[model samples]
Target: MPVSHPDPIWVTDNDTLATYCTQWLKLDAIALDTEFIRTDTFYPKPGLIQLGTGQEVFLLDPLKIDNWQPFAQLLGSEQVVKVLHACSEDIEVFHILSGNKPAAIFDTQLAASYAGLGHSLGYQNLLKTLLGVDLPKDATRSDWLQRPLTDIQVSYATLDVVHLLEVYQLLQQRLKPMPHWNWLLEDCSNLSNGDLYPKPEEQWKEVKRAWQLRPRQLCVLKVLAEYREREARRSNVPRNRVIPRGSLWPLARYMPDNIHSLSAIQDMRHSNIRHYGEEVLSLIEMARELPGEQHPKPLPAPLPKAAKEHGQRLKRYTSQKAEELNLPVELLMLGKILTPMLRSRLEYGLFKLPEQLQGWRRTVFAEPMVEQLNQPEQ
Candidate 1:
């Protein structure tokens, strides 16, 4: 039988939030979710937060509450597990609000993947699959920041956590008996503990066509990307607002030295040219003057056609193993981890295990993956 959930309590002031948080601190686990807008800012603009204690759902208005110390302490309490679905963005909102990441977290999406439910399953689908509940989708893009939320929007937000608590309970029953139960917790911990903010120094690697640039050219792109990242954060604007990413590659390749040359680059906005053209030229000049040793190491080129067979073989073996284990292939052998391993073997002629593959994966597939890599091409 489906459980009848109570109406969500609206939390508009600090005292109510603190009082409920105190009671919630005593619970073993709680369901959590956040509603935020991120169309134009480097940081998400939090609008509402929803929490479920298995008994009642609470809707917290970020615009109304001031003190979050009590909730911060609850989030930091290692004894209590915070349950969320697809928690990456929610983690960011929590950190921004409380200055603390949940000490313990269980992400239902990841949990479902581990349980062989599906990879990257949407919350609505997961609910329909596990609990036979259908959620309304009308309020997904509604303005959550606006005051006097519509009744439909409020119901949608409340159901986000209300059904989540049920999902958590169902997944717990399915996963607790499995050997990989702790693995789900481990991955969730890594997700929450990860640095949500982008690092300026490493930002260049994300630019499209960045690998085409030579070492010295890469240095110029690196500095330009760093400047854009820093300026975006400082001004609370999106990265492209500072300088369009499409312009970075051309600026690096052409080594633009003046406003005219900089302006000629593709996607270079007039505002960017007028504001940052001088600094861009100066950065490029400084990069050119840098000694050879200071240049960034060259990015790896694409593998030749003949070498691709090795990655294909590794993928085949990994997919078979994932099937045997009743898990998603992506959960077992992510391309980000596999591609770097293949590149290392090609360059150094020896397989080096990446740190990401060192945990439960090491126990499961590490030896076989290395052996597969060492196999000679047919």
Candidate 2:
């Protein structure tokens, strides 16, 4: 049966929120979820925060409630375990709300993944699969920022957290006997780390076609992406609003030195070029003028036929290892994460494993894989 709570009390101001959070701090655990919109903004526009304390459900109107400091304190309190699911964006909303991240969180989705519930499982599906309950997801596209949310919206949002406590409890029971059961706790604790979001200076690596750019072109793309990230943070607009990413590679490739040359780049919006005209020109000119020694290292050429053959061996190794452990291949190490390093080793004879491949992954697969990674294909 679906768990039921009293009709959610709509808390629109600080005093009620303070009262609720005061009681919430006394609890050992709570279920949490957020309804937010990020359609046109760099930062998510918080609409509603749905909190479940096992005994009660509270719907906090972030638009109307200005003081979230108490709830933020509750989040940071050592005793309270905040339960959530697939919570990366929810962390962002909480950060914007109170300048704090929830500490001691249990991500049921991640826990369920380990419990044989599968990767990236949705809350509704987990409920159906584990608890035999069907959760309605009708209000998924509702405008949460709009006031006077309909009954369906409230019901949908409330359902997001109401049964989460039940799910968390069931997941805990299911996960308890697994070999790496504690891995969920470790992964959950790591989620609270301050570096969950992308660093602006490091954002350039996420751009498409980035690896194709040469040393100087890469330098230009890096600086341009950094500028856009910082600008998005400053103006609270999406990065694409500043300059579309596809436009970046061409600008770097052509080394557009003036407004006219920039205009010739197919994707650079004319209005954006005019607005940031001088600044963009100066950046390109600076890259062009960099001394040869100061230029970044050249991009490695494509892999040779022998290197391509070696990749097949790596793939077979990953599949065999995953089968032995009875874990998803991705949980071992994603192809994107593993193959890139292998390619780099073949291309430049350099090897650096991704930070994510450490801890449990290192013990299981990484050590053996690294030993054979450099061996010629059999």
lDDT by residue for model 2 over 278-344, one digit each (tens)? 8888887887777767665555555567666656766788889877866666666666575666676
lDDT (tens digit, per residue) of candidate 1 on 110-227: 9999888899999988988998887777899889899999988888888888878778888999999997698888898888678989789999998887889998999898888999
Model 1: CA > 4 A from native: 1-5, 372-378
Candidate 1 contains a number of clashing pairs equal to 0
Top candidate when judged by TM-score against the true structure: 1
> For candidate 1, which ten residues in a row score worst on lDDT?
1-10
RMSD of 2: 2.7
